[model samples]
Target: MLLPSLYFEEGFKVIGNMVNTAFGKFNLTGKTALITGAAGLLGQQHASALLEIGATVVLTDISAEALGAACTALSCESTASRILTRVMDVSRAESITTVAEEFSDRRIDILVNNAAIDPKVNGDAGIQETSRLENFPLVQWELQLAVGLTGAFLCSQVFGSAMASDGRGGVILNIASDLSVFSPDQRLYRKEGLPADLQPVKPVTYSVIKAGLVGLTRYLATYWAEQGVRANALSPGGVFNGQGDEFVTRLTSLIPLGRMAKADEYQSVVQFLCTDASAYLNGQNIVMDGGRSVW
Candidate 1:
Protein backbone atom coordinates (compact mmCIF):
# COMPACT_ATOMS: atom_id res chain seq x y z
CA MET A 1 0.00 0.00 0.00
CA LEU A 2 1.16 3.55 -0.79
CA LEU A 3 2.10 5.92 2.02
CA PRO A 4 -0.30 8.67 2.99
CA SER A 5 -0.12 11.90 0.86
CA LEU A 6 1.45 13.89 3.76
CA TYR A 7 4.13 11.24 4.32
CA PHE A 8 5.08 11.19 0.61
CA GLU A 9 5.32 14.99 0.49
CA GLU A 10 7.60 15.06 3.55
CA GLY A 11 9.83 12.29 2.17
CA PHE A 12 10.24 14.01 -1.18
CA LYS A 13 11.15 17.31 0.49
CA VAL A 14 13.77 15.58 2.67
CA ILE A 15 15.37 13.90 -0.36
CA GLY A 16 15.49 17.19 -2.27
CA ASN A 17 17.13 18.96 0.67
CA MET A 18 19.75 16.24 0.95
CA VAL A 19 20.55 16.50 -2.76
CA ASN A 20 20.93 20.25 -2.52
CA THR A 21 23.30 19.91 0.41
CA ALA A 22 25.47 17.41 -1.42
CA PHE A 23 25.75 19.50 -4.57
CA GLY A 24 26.20 22.66 -2.52
CA LYS A 25 29.70 21.61 -1.54
CA PHE A 26 30.87 22.81 -4.96
CA ASN A 27 28.80 25.98 -4.81
CA LEU A 28 30.48 29.24 -3.77
CA THR A 29 27.41 31.43 -3.54
CA GLY A 30 27.83 34.46 -1.26
CA LYS A 31 31.62 33.96 -1.08
CA THR A 32 33.92 36.74 -2.32
CA ALA A 33 37.21 36.11 -4.16
CA LEU A 34 39.91 38.71 -4.73
CA ILE A 35 42.28 38.09 -7.65
CA THR A 36 45.55 40.00 -8.06
CA GLY A 37 46.75 40.94 -11.57
CA ALA A 38 43.23 40.35 -12.76
CA ALA A 39 43.83 42.29 -15.98
CA GLY A 40 46.27 39.71 -17.33
CA LEU A 41 45.32 36.70 -19.46
CA LEU A 42 45.42 33.99 -16.82
CA GLY A 43 44.03 36.33 -14.21
CA GLN A 44 40.91 36.96 -16.26
CA GLN A 45 40.44 33.21 -16.67
CA HIS A 46 40.78 32.70 -12.91
CA ALA A 47 38.14 35.33 -12.25
CA SER A 48 35.83 33.65 -14.75
CA ALA A 49 36.29 30.31 -13.06
CA LEU A 50 35.29 31.68 -9.65
CA LEU A 51 32.42 33.64 -11.15
CA GLU A 52 31.06 30.53 -12.86
CA ILE A 53 30.90 28.91 -9.44
CA GLY A 54 28.89 31.84 -8.04
CA ALA A 55 31.51 33.80 -6.11
CA THR A 56 31.63 37.58 -6.25
CA VAL A 57 35.03 38.53 -7.70
CA VAL A 58 37.24 41.54 -7.06
CA LEU A 59 39.55 42.05 -10.06
CA THR A 60 42.68 43.99 -9.11
CA ASP A 61 45.65 45.12 -11.16
CA ILE A 62 48.34 47.78 -11.14
CA SER A 63 46.88 49.54 -14.19
CA ALA A 64 43.51 51.09 -13.59
CA GLU A 65 42.86 51.31 -17.33
CA ALA A 66 43.65 47.64 -17.94
CA LEU A 67 41.67 46.66 -14.85
CA GLY A 68 38.69 48.66 -16.07
CA ALA A 69 38.88 46.96 -19.46
CA ALA A 70 39.08 43.53 -17.88
CA CYS A 71 36.15 44.32 -15.59
CA THR A 72 34.09 45.48 -18.52
CA ALA A 73 34.97 42.39 -20.53
CA LEU A 74 33.84 40.07 -17.73
CA SER A 75 30.72 41.99 -16.79
CA CYS A 76 27.34 40.98 -18.19
CA GLU A 77 23.78 41.52 -17.12
CA SER A 78 23.81 38.32 -15.11
CA THR A 79 27.29 38.76 -13.60
CA ALA A 80 27.39 42.56 -13.26
CA SER A 81 26.41 42.44 -9.60
CA ARG A 82 29.15 39.93 -8.85
CA ILE A 83 32.08 41.86 -10.36
CA LEU A 84 34.19 44.52 -8.62
CA THR A 85 37.46 46.11 -9.65
CA ARG A 86 40.28 47.78 -7.71
CA VAL A 87 43.73 49.09 -8.55
CA MET A 88 46.28 47.25 -6.44
CA ASP A 89 50.04 47.14 -6.76
CA VAL A 90 50.85 43.81 -5.19
CA SER A 91 54.49 44.79 -4.61
CA ARG A 92 53.59 47.58 -2.17
CA ALA A 93 52.30 46.89 1.33
CA GLU A 94 50.38 50.14 1.45
CA SER A 95 48.49 49.38 -1.77
CA ILE A 96 47.42 45.99 -0.50
CA THR A 97 46.45 47.48 2.86
CA THR A 98 44.32 50.14 1.23
CA VAL A 99 42.35 47.59 -0.77
CA ALA A 100 41.96 45.42 2.29
CA GLU A 101 40.51 48.34 4.20
CA GLU A 102 38.20 49.32 1.34
CA PHE A 103 36.60 45.90 1.53
CA SER A 104 36.67 45.69 5.30
CA ASP A 105 32.89 45.59 5.52
CA ARG A 106 32.80 42.45 3.38
CA ARG A 107 34.42 39.10 3.96
CA ILE A 108 36.85 37.82 1.32
CA ASP A 109 36.70 34.04 1.20
CA ILE A 110 39.35 33.43 -1.46
CA LEU A 111 42.58 35.00 -2.65
CA VAL A 112 44.23 34.24 -6.00
CA ASN A 113 47.81 35.49 -6.16
CA ASN A 114 48.28 35.65 -9.95
CA ALA A 115 50.61 38.60 -10.37
CA ALA A 116 54.06 38.19 -11.93
CA ILE A 117 56.42 39.76 -14.43
CA ASP A 118 56.93 37.36 -17.35
CA PRO A 119 59.32 38.99 -19.80
CA LYS A 120 58.93 37.54 -23.26
CA VAL A 121 62.00 36.51 -25.23
CA ASN A 122 62.07 37.33 -28.94
CA GLY A 123 64.52 37.26 -31.84
CA ASP A 124 65.67 40.77 -30.95
CA ALA A 125 69.42 40.59 -30.39
CA GLY A 126 69.42 43.26 -27.71
CA ILE A 127 66.75 41.54 -25.62
CA GLN A 128 68.40 38.16 -25.95
CA GLU A 129 71.77 39.45 -24.76
CA THR A 130 70.31 41.27 -21.76
CA SER A 131 68.29 38.18 -20.74
CA ARG A 132 71.50 36.18 -20.38
CA LEU A 133 71.97 35.16 -16.74
CA GLU A 134 75.31 36.94 -16.49
CA ASN A 135 73.99 40.14 -18.06
CA PHE A 136 70.59 40.14 -16.31
CA PRO A 137 70.19 43.52 -14.61
CA LEU A 138 70.04 43.82 -10.82
CA VAL A 139 67.05 46.13 -11.05
CA GLN A 140 65.07 43.70 -13.18
CA TRP A 141 65.81 40.84 -10.81
CA GLU A 142 64.71 42.84 -7.78
CA LEU A 143 61.54 44.06 -9.46
CA GLN A 144 60.59 40.57 -10.60
CA LEU A 145 61.03 39.15 -7.12
CA ALA A 146 59.14 42.02 -5.56
CA VAL A 147 56.14 41.30 -7.74
CA GLY A 148 56.20 37.52 -8.07
CA LEU A 149 57.50 36.38 -4.70
CA THR A 150 57.23 39.22 -2.21
CA GLY A 151 53.86 40.18 -3.57
CA ALA A 152 52.40 36.79 -2.81
CA PHE A 153 53.87 37.02 0.67
CA LEU A 154 52.35 40.43 1.37
CA CYS A 155 48.95 39.48 0.02
CA SER A 156 48.96 36.34 2.10
CA GLN A 157 50.06 38.27 5.14
CA VAL A 158 47.32 40.85 4.90
CA PHE A 159 44.43 38.87 3.44
CA GLY A 160 45.43 35.54 4.90
CA SER A 161 45.73 36.93 8.40
CA ALA A 162 42.25 38.29 8.09
CA MET A 163 41.04 34.91 6.83
CA ALA A 164 42.55 33.18 9.83
CA SER A 165 41.07 35.56 12.37
CA ASP A 166 37.63 35.87 10.80
CA GLY A 167 36.69 32.35 11.96
CA ARG A 168 35.15 31.52 8.58
CA GLY A 169 38.49 30.39 7.09
CA GLY A 170 39.45 30.80 3.39
CA VAL A 171 41.53 29.65 0.42
CA ILE A 172 44.78 31.16 -0.90
CA LEU A 173 45.92 30.02 -4.34
CA ASN A 174 49.37 30.96 -5.61
CA ILE A 175 49.64 30.94 -9.41
CA ALA A 176 53.05 29.40 -9.92
CA SER A 177 54.60 27.86 -13.03
CA ASP A 178 55.74 24.40 -14.11
CA LEU A 179 59.22 25.90 -13.99
CA SER A 180 58.81 25.75 -10.25
CA VAL A 181 59.34 21.99 -10.44
CA PHE A 182 61.72 21.83 -13.43
CA SER A 183 64.31 24.11 -14.87
CA PRO A 184 63.38 25.85 -18.10
CA ASP A 185 64.52 23.97 -21.21
CA GLN A 186 66.62 26.84 -22.49
CA ARG A 187 66.94 24.98 -25.79
CA LEU A 188 63.32 25.82 -26.54
CA TYR A 189 64.26 29.49 -26.69
CA ARG A 190 67.49 29.20 -28.74
CA LYS A 191 67.43 31.00 -32.09
CA GLU A 192 68.72 29.26 -35.21
CA GLY A 193 72.02 31.22 -35.44
CA LEU A 194 72.38 32.98 -32.12
CA PRO A 195 75.86 33.09 -30.61
CA ALA A 196 76.50 31.36 -27.30
CA ASP A 197 76.44 34.66 -25.41
CA LEU A 198 73.33 35.88 -27.22
CA GLN A 199 71.04 32.86 -26.77
CA PRO A 200 67.93 33.85 -24.83
CA VAL A 201 67.21 32.03 -21.62
CA LYS A 202 64.22 32.31 -19.33
CA PRO A 203 65.12 34.72 -16.55
CA VAL A 204 66.47 33.17 -13.35
CA THR A 205 63.87 35.09 -11.36
CA TYR A 206 60.96 33.22 -12.96
CA SER A 207 62.07 29.87 -11.62
CA VAL A 208 63.08 31.29 -8.26
CA ILE A 209 59.81 33.11 -7.74
CA LYS A 210 57.65 30.16 -8.78
CA ALA A 211 59.57 27.81 -6.52
CA GLY A 212 59.28 30.25 -3.65
CA LEU A 213 55.51 30.31 -4.02
CA VAL A 214 55.34 26.57 -3.49
CA GLY A 215 57.40 26.97 -0.32
CA LEU A 216 55.07 29.70 0.87
CA THR A 217 52.11 27.44 0.16
CA ARG A 218 53.43 24.83 2.56
CA TYR A 219 54.09 27.41 5.25
CA LEU A 220 50.63 28.95 5.07
CA ALA A 221 48.89 25.58 4.80
CA THR A 222 50.05 24.62 8.28
CA TYR A 223 50.27 28.13 9.71
CA TRP A 224 46.53 28.52 9.59
CA ALA A 225 45.30 24.92 9.67
CA GLU A 226 44.02 25.36 13.21
CA GLN A 227 42.34 28.53 12.06
CA GLY A 228 40.58 26.70 9.19
CA VAL A 229 42.40 28.41 6.31
CA ARG A 230 44.00 26.42 3.48
CA ALA A 231 46.76 27.25 1.03
CA ASN A 232 47.95 25.63 -2.23
CA ALA A 233 49.86 26.47 -5.39
CA LEU A 234 48.98 25.90 -9.05
CA SER A 235 51.94 25.18 -11.31
CA PRO A 236 50.70 25.69 -14.86
CA GLY A 237 52.62 24.97 -18.04
CA GLY A 238 52.85 27.29 -21.06
CA VAL A 239 49.64 28.39 -22.67
CA PHE A 240 49.24 28.51 -26.44
CA ASN A 241 49.53 32.20 -27.10
CA GLY A 242 50.67 33.22 -30.58
CA GLN A 243 54.35 32.35 -30.80
CA GLY A 244 56.75 31.39 -33.58
CA ASP A 245 56.02 27.95 -35.01
CA GLU A 246 59.62 26.95 -34.41
CA PHE A 247 59.39 27.71 -30.74
CA VAL A 248 55.99 26.05 -30.43
CA THR A 249 57.22 22.86 -32.07
CA ARG A 250 60.28 22.72 -29.84
CA LEU A 251 58.20 23.23 -26.70
CA THR A 252 55.52 20.74 -27.65
CA SER A 253 58.03 18.05 -28.52
CA LEU A 254 58.99 17.88 -24.84
CA ILE A 255 55.42 17.33 -23.67
CA PRO A 256 53.92 13.87 -23.61
CA LEU A 257 50.63 15.44 -24.68
CA GLY A 258 52.45 17.08 -27.60
CA ARG A 259 50.46 20.31 -27.25
CA MET A 260 50.36 23.38 -25.07
CA ALA A 261 47.30 24.12 -22.95
CA LYS A 262 44.53 26.39 -24.15
CA ALA A 263 44.08 29.63 -22.27
CA ASP A 264 40.88 28.50 -20.58
CA GLU A 265 42.02 24.96 -19.80
CA TYR A 266 42.97 25.80 -16.21
CA GLN A 267 39.63 27.32 -15.21
CA SER A 268 38.05 24.13 -13.86
CA VAL A 269 41.17 23.37 -11.86
CA VAL A 270 41.14 26.93 -10.50
CA GLN A 271 37.55 26.45 -9.43
CA PHE A 272 38.43 23.21 -7.69
CA LEU A 273 41.37 24.69 -5.80
CA CYS A 274 39.41 27.77 -4.75
CA THR A 275 36.25 26.00 -3.64
CA ASP A 276 35.20 23.31 -1.12
CA ALA A 277 35.74 20.77 -3.90
CA SER A 278 39.34 20.63 -2.75
CA ALA A 279 38.65 20.73 0.99
CA TYR A 280 41.25 18.10 1.88
CA LEU A 281 43.88 19.44 -0.53
CA ASN A 282 46.39 21.76 1.11
CA GLY A 283 50.14 22.39 1.19
CA GLN A 284 50.25 20.87 -2.29
CA ASN A 285 51.51 22.18 -5.61
CA ILE A 286 49.15 20.95 -8.31
CA VAL A 287 51.19 20.96 -11.53
CA MET A 288 49.32 21.12 -14.86
CA ASP A 289 52.16 20.85 -17.29
CA GLY A 290 50.74 18.39 -19.82
CA GLY A 291 53.17 15.64 -18.70
CA ARG A 292 56.18 17.67 -19.76
CA SER A 293 57.59 17.84 -16.23
CA VAL A 294 57.37 14.05 -15.90
CA TRP A 295 59.04 13.48 -19.24
Candidate 2:
Protein backbone atom coordinates (compact mmCIF):
# COMPACT_ATOMS: atom_id res chain seq x y z
CA MET A 1 0.00 0.00 0.00
CA LEU A 2 2.95 2.29 0.62
CA LEU A 3 5.61 3.62 -1.76
CA PRO A 4 8.93 1.89 -2.41
CA SER A 5 11.72 2.31 0.16
CA LEU A 6 13.70 4.70 -2.06
CA TYR A 7 10.66 6.82 -2.71
CA PHE A 8 9.86 7.04 1.02
CA GLU A 9 13.41 8.11 1.80
CA GLU A 10 13.31 10.75 -0.90
CA GLY A 11 9.98 12.02 0.38
CA PHE A 12 11.40 12.29 3.88
CA LYS A 13 14.34 14.27 2.58
CA VAL A 14 12.09 16.62 0.69
CA ILE A 15 9.98 17.26 3.79
CA GLY A 16 13.05 17.98 5.85
CA ASN A 17 14.34 20.43 3.29
CA MET A 18 11.05 22.23 3.16
CA VAL A 19 10.93 22.55 6.92
CA ASN A 20 14.48 23.84 7.06
CA THR A 21 13.85 26.42 4.41
CA ALA A 22 10.66 27.59 6.08
CA PHE A 23 12.37 28.09 9.41
CA GLY A 24 15.79 29.01 8.11
CA LYS A 25 17.53 32.35 8.38
CA PHE A 26 16.82 35.40 6.25
CA ASN A 27 19.24 38.14 5.23
CA LEU A 28 18.51 41.81 4.45
CA THR A 29 21.10 42.35 1.76
CA GLY A 30 19.15 44.81 -0.36
CA LYS A 31 17.02 46.46 2.31
CA THR A 32 17.36 49.74 4.24
CA ALA A 33 16.34 50.20 7.87
CA LEU A 34 15.14 53.61 9.04
CA ILE A 35 15.65 54.05 12.75
CA THR A 36 14.50 57.06 14.76
CA GLY A 37 16.03 57.73 18.17
CA ALA A 38 18.76 55.93 16.35
CA ALA A 39 21.64 56.99 18.61
CA GLY A 40 20.41 55.84 22.01
CA LEU A 41 21.58 52.62 23.61
CA LEU A 42 18.91 50.36 22.18
CA GLY A 43 18.84 52.25 18.92
CA GLN A 44 22.56 51.73 18.28
CA GLN A 45 22.26 48.05 19.02
CA HIS A 46 19.40 47.75 16.56
CA ALA A 47 21.29 49.71 13.94
CA SER A 48 24.53 47.80 14.40
CA ALA A 49 22.80 44.46 14.45
CA LEU A 50 20.81 45.17 11.30
CA LEU A 51 23.88 46.44 9.52
CA GLU A 52 25.78 43.34 10.56
CA ILE A 53 23.02 41.25 9.06
CA GLY A 54 23.32 43.12 5.73
CA ALA A 55 20.73 45.88 5.85
CA THR A 56 21.81 49.41 5.04
CA VAL A 57 20.75 51.42 8.09
CA VAL A 58 19.49 55.00 8.01
CA LEU A 59 20.04 56.45 11.48
CA THR A 60 18.36 59.60 12.81
CA ASP A 61 18.41 61.33 16.18
CA ILE A 62 17.49 64.62 17.80
CA SER A 63 21.12 65.54 18.34
CA ALA A 64 23.30 66.30 15.35
CA GLU A 65 26.29 65.13 17.33
CA ALA A 66 24.53 61.92 18.23
CA LEU A 67 23.69 61.18 14.62
CA GLY A 68 27.29 61.99 13.63
CA ALA A 69 28.57 59.70 16.33
CA ALA A 70 26.39 56.84 15.18
CA CYS A 71 27.51 57.26 11.58
CA THR A 72 31.16 57.54 12.60
CA ALA A 73 30.96 54.42 14.71
CA LEU A 74 29.23 52.43 11.99
CA SER A 75 31.53 53.70 9.25
CA CYS A 76 34.74 53.48 11.26
CA GLU A 77 35.84 50.09 10.06
CA SER A 78 33.82 47.50 8.15
CA THR A 79 30.42 48.56 9.50
CA ALA A 80 30.73 52.23 8.54
CA SER A 81 29.99 51.45 4.95
CA ARG A 82 26.40 50.54 5.85
CA ILE A 83 25.08 53.56 7.75
CA LEU A 84 23.42 56.84 6.75
CA THR A 85 22.86 59.50 9.42
CA ARG A 86 20.36 62.32 9.88
CA VAL A 87 19.49 64.80 12.62
CA MET A 88 15.75 64.73 13.24
CA ASP A 89 13.35 66.08 15.81
CA VAL A 90 10.45 63.62 15.80
CA SER A 91 8.28 66.22 17.53
CA ARG A 92 8.24 68.39 14.45
CA ALA A 93 6.15 67.21 11.49
CA GLU A 94 8.08 69.70 9.36
CA SER A 95 11.38 68.10 10.28
CA ILE A 96 10.02 64.71 9.32
CA THR A 97 8.54 66.10 6.09
CA THR A 98 11.84 67.66 5.15
CA VAL A 99 13.65 64.37 5.50
CA ALA A 100 10.83 62.64 3.67
CA GLU A 101 11.37 64.93 0.69
CA GLU A 102 15.12 64.48 0.84
CA PHE A 103 14.45 60.78 0.55
CA SER A 104 11.89 61.72 -2.10
CA ASP A 105 11.93 58.72 -4.34
CA ARG A 106 13.34 56.08 -2.01
CA ARG A 107 11.70 53.25 -0.14
CA ILE A 108 12.53 52.46 3.47
CA ASP A 109 12.26 48.69 3.93
CA ILE A 110 11.99 48.83 7.68
CA LEU A 111 11.10 51.52 10.21
CA VAL A 112 11.94 51.44 13.95
CA ASN A 113 10.09 54.13 15.91
CA ASN A 114 11.93 54.40 19.23
CA ALA A 115 12.25 58.08 20.21
CA ALA A 116 11.30 59.37 23.69
CA ILE A 117 11.90 61.85 26.55
CA ASP A 118 12.07 61.48 30.34
CA PRO A 119 10.39 64.77 31.25
CA LYS A 120 9.57 65.61 34.89
CA VAL A 121 5.93 65.74 35.96
CA ASN A 122 6.11 68.35 38.71
CA GLY A 123 9.05 69.56 40.82
CA ASP A 124 10.30 66.05 40.26
CA ALA A 125 7.03 64.30 39.45
CA GLY A 126 6.57 63.64 35.73
CA ILE A 127 2.89 64.46 35.01
CA GLN A 128 1.41 67.93 35.22
CA GLU A 129 -2.34 67.71 35.50
CA THR A 130 -4.01 68.85 32.34
CA SER A 131 -7.50 70.29 32.61
CA ARG A 132 -8.50 67.51 30.26
CA LEU A 133 -5.40 67.23 28.11
CA GLU A 134 -7.17 70.37 26.87
CA ASN A 135 -5.61 72.87 29.26
CA PHE A 136 -2.39 70.88 29.10
CA PRO A 137 0.77 72.91 28.93
CA LEU A 138 1.57 73.80 25.35
CA VAL A 139 4.99 72.25 25.84
CA GLN A 140 4.91 69.22 28.16
CA TRP A 141 2.35 66.57 27.22
CA GLU A 142 1.99 67.80 23.66
CA LEU A 143 5.70 67.93 23.18
CA GLN A 144 6.30 64.47 24.62
CA LEU A 145 3.48 62.85 22.65
CA ALA A 146 4.60 64.59 19.49
CA VAL A 147 8.04 63.04 19.72
CA GLY A 148 6.92 59.66 20.96
CA LEU A 149 3.66 59.16 19.08
CA THR A 150 3.11 61.71 16.31
CA GLY A 151 6.65 61.30 15.06
CA ALA A 152 6.08 57.58 14.67
CA PHE A 153 2.81 58.20 12.87
CA LEU A 154 4.38 60.77 10.57
CA CYS A 155 7.18 58.38 9.65
CA SER A 156 4.71 55.62 8.97
CA GLN A 157 2.50 57.83 6.84
CA VAL A 158 5.35 59.34 4.87
CA PHE A 159 7.85 56.52 4.64
CA GLY A 160 5.20 53.81 4.63
CA SER A 161 3.51 55.35 1.62
CA ALA A 162 6.74 55.28 -0.33
CA MET A 163 7.57 51.74 0.76
CA ALA A 164 4.18 50.40 -0.30
CA SER A 165 3.89 52.30 -3.56
CA ASP A 166 7.11 50.67 -4.62
CA GLY A 167 4.94 47.53 -4.79
CA ARG A 168 6.94 45.99 -1.96
CA GLY A 169 5.74 45.42 1.57
CA GLY A 170 7.96 46.28 4.54
CA VAL A 171 8.34 45.95 8.31
CA ILE A 172 7.55 48.61 10.94
CA LEU A 173 8.71 47.86 14.46
CA ASN A 174 7.59 50.25 17.18
CA ILE A 175 9.72 50.15 20.33
CA ALA A 176 7.38 50.23 23.27
CA SER A 177 8.12 49.27 26.90
CA ASP A 178 6.66 47.13 29.68
CA LEU A 179 5.52 50.47 31.09
CA SER A 180 2.79 50.23 28.51
CA VAL A 181 1.19 47.96 31.03
CA PHE A 182 0.83 48.76 34.74
CA SER A 183 4.46 49.68 35.40
CA PRO A 184 4.27 49.54 39.19
CA ASP A 185 7.96 49.56 40.18
CA GLN A 186 9.43 50.90 36.98
CA ARG A 187 8.99 54.66 37.43
CA LEU A 188 11.29 57.23 35.78
CA TYR A 189 11.02 60.61 37.56
CA ARG A 190 12.99 61.97 40.54
CA LYS A 191 10.09 63.85 42.12
CA GLU A 192 7.86 63.00 45.11
CA GLY A 193 4.05 63.39 45.50
CA LEU A 194 3.74 62.55 41.84
CA PRO A 195 0.48 61.43 40.32
CA ALA A 196 0.10 57.66 40.43
CA ASP A 197 0.71 57.80 36.71
CA LEU A 198 3.96 59.83 36.78
CA GLN A 199 5.82 58.24 39.70
CA PRO A 200 9.47 57.32 39.39
CA VAL A 201 8.55 53.68 39.44
CA LYS A 202 6.62 54.31 36.21
CA PRO A 203 6.68 57.68 34.48
CA VAL A 204 3.28 58.97 33.38
CA THR A 205 4.13 60.27 29.96
CA TYR A 206 6.22 57.26 29.03
CA SER A 207 3.40 54.86 29.83
CA VAL A 208 0.62 56.86 28.21
CA ILE A 209 2.59 57.51 25.06
CA LYS A 210 3.58 53.87 24.63
CA ALA A 211 0.06 52.67 25.27
CA GLY A 212 -1.04 54.88 22.42
CA LEU A 213 1.41 53.12 20.13
CA VAL A 214 -0.56 49.91 20.55
CA GLY A 215 -3.49 51.56 18.84
CA LEU A 216 -1.34 53.24 16.23
CA THR A 217 0.26 49.96 15.29
CA ARG A 218 -3.09 48.19 15.11
CA TYR A 219 -4.65 50.87 12.97
CA LEU A 220 -1.71 50.88 10.60
CA ALA A 221 -1.53 47.11 10.42
CA THR A 222 -5.17 46.93 9.39
CA TYR A 223 -4.88 49.93 7.12
CA TRP A 224 -1.81 48.70 5.29
CA ALA A 225 -2.28 44.93 5.21
CA GLU A 226 -3.63 45.00 1.68
CA GLN A 227 -0.62 47.07 0.68
CA GLY A 228 1.92 44.50 1.94
CA VAL A 229 3.00 46.52 5.00
CA ARG A 230 3.30 44.97 8.47
CA ALA A 231 3.18 46.79 11.82
CA ASN A 232 3.88 45.51 15.34
CA ALA A 233 5.20 46.61 18.72
CA LEU A 234 7.91 45.21 20.95
CA SER A 235 7.40 45.82 24.67
CA PRO A 236 10.87 45.28 26.06
CA GLY A 237 11.48 44.61 29.70
CA GLY A 238 13.32 47.08 31.92
CA VAL A 239 16.82 47.17 30.51
CA PHE A 240 19.82 47.31 32.80
CA ASN A 241 23.10 49.26 32.43
CA GLY A 242 21.76 52.58 31.16
CA GLN A 243 19.51 53.51 34.06
CA GLY A 244 20.56 54.92 37.45
CA ASP A 245 21.50 52.43 40.17
CA GLU A 246 18.38 53.00 42.27
CA PHE A 247 15.95 52.50 39.42
CA VAL A 248 17.89 49.52 38.14
CA THR A 249 17.82 47.80 41.53
CA ARG A 250 14.06 48.21 41.88
CA LEU A 251 13.39 46.95 38.36
CA THR A 252 15.67 43.94 38.72
CA SER A 253 13.85 42.76 41.81
CA LEU A 254 10.51 42.91 40.00
CA ILE A 255 11.63 40.67 37.18
CA PRO A 256 10.89 36.96 37.29
CA LEU A 257 14.14 36.38 35.43
CA GLY A 258 15.76 37.68 38.65
CA ARG A 259 17.70 40.20 36.59
CA MET A 260 17.17 43.06 34.25
CA ALA A 261 17.61 42.51 30.53
CA LYS A 262 20.79 43.58 28.80
CA ALA A 263 20.42 45.40 25.52
CA ASP A 264 21.88 42.55 23.49
CA GLU A 265 19.12 40.17 24.54
CA TYR A 266 16.56 42.10 22.52
CA GLN A 267 18.40 41.85 19.22
CA SER A 268 17.04 38.53 18.01
CA VAL A 269 13.40 39.47 18.48
CA VAL A 270 13.89 42.79 16.75
CA GLN A 271 15.76 41.19 13.91
CA PHE A 272 13.03 38.66 13.35
CA LEU A 273 10.19 41.17 13.48
CA CYS A 274 12.09 43.62 11.29
CA THR A 275 12.96 41.11 8.60
CA ASP A 276 11.09 38.77 6.30
CA ALA A 277 11.06 36.19 9.07
CA SER A 278 7.98 37.78 10.60
CA ALA A 279 6.26 38.55 7.36
CA TYR A 280 2.82 37.46 8.52
CA LEU A 281 2.82 38.88 12.07
CA ASN A 282 1.17 42.27 12.42
CA GLY A 283 -0.84 44.35 14.88
CA GLN A 284 0.62 42.48 17.83
CA ASN A 285 2.47 43.72 20.89
CA ILE A 286 5.08 41.10 21.62
CA VAL A 287 6.29 41.62 25.21
CA MET A 288 9.88 40.70 25.99
CA ASP A 289 9.54 41.03 29.75
CA GLY A 290 11.09 37.80 31.01
CA GLY A 291 7.70 36.49 32.14
CA ARG A 292 7.09 39.46 34.44
CA SER A 293 3.63 39.80 32.97
CA VAL A 294 2.97 36.15 33.73
CA TRP A 295 3.77 36.57 37.37
TM-score of each: 0.92, 0.82
How many clashes in each candidate? 0, 13
TM match of model 1 to true structure: 0.92
Best by lDDT: 1
Candidate 2 local lDDT, 1-295, one digit each (tens): 8779999899999999998876555678878889999988899888877876789888999899888887777776446667888888888888888887877665688999988775533334334434223334566777788889988898888888877887688888899877676554434334455555433333456778888988898998988788899999999887776566765666666678888888789888888888778888999999999878777
Model 1, 90: alpha-carbon shift in Å?
0.6
Best by TM-score: 1
lDDT of 1 by residue, 136-171 (tens): 999999999999999999999999999999788999
lDDT of each: 0.93, 0.78
Off by over 4 Å in 1: 1-22
- Model 1 misses residue 274 by how many Å? 0.9
lDDT of 2: 0.78
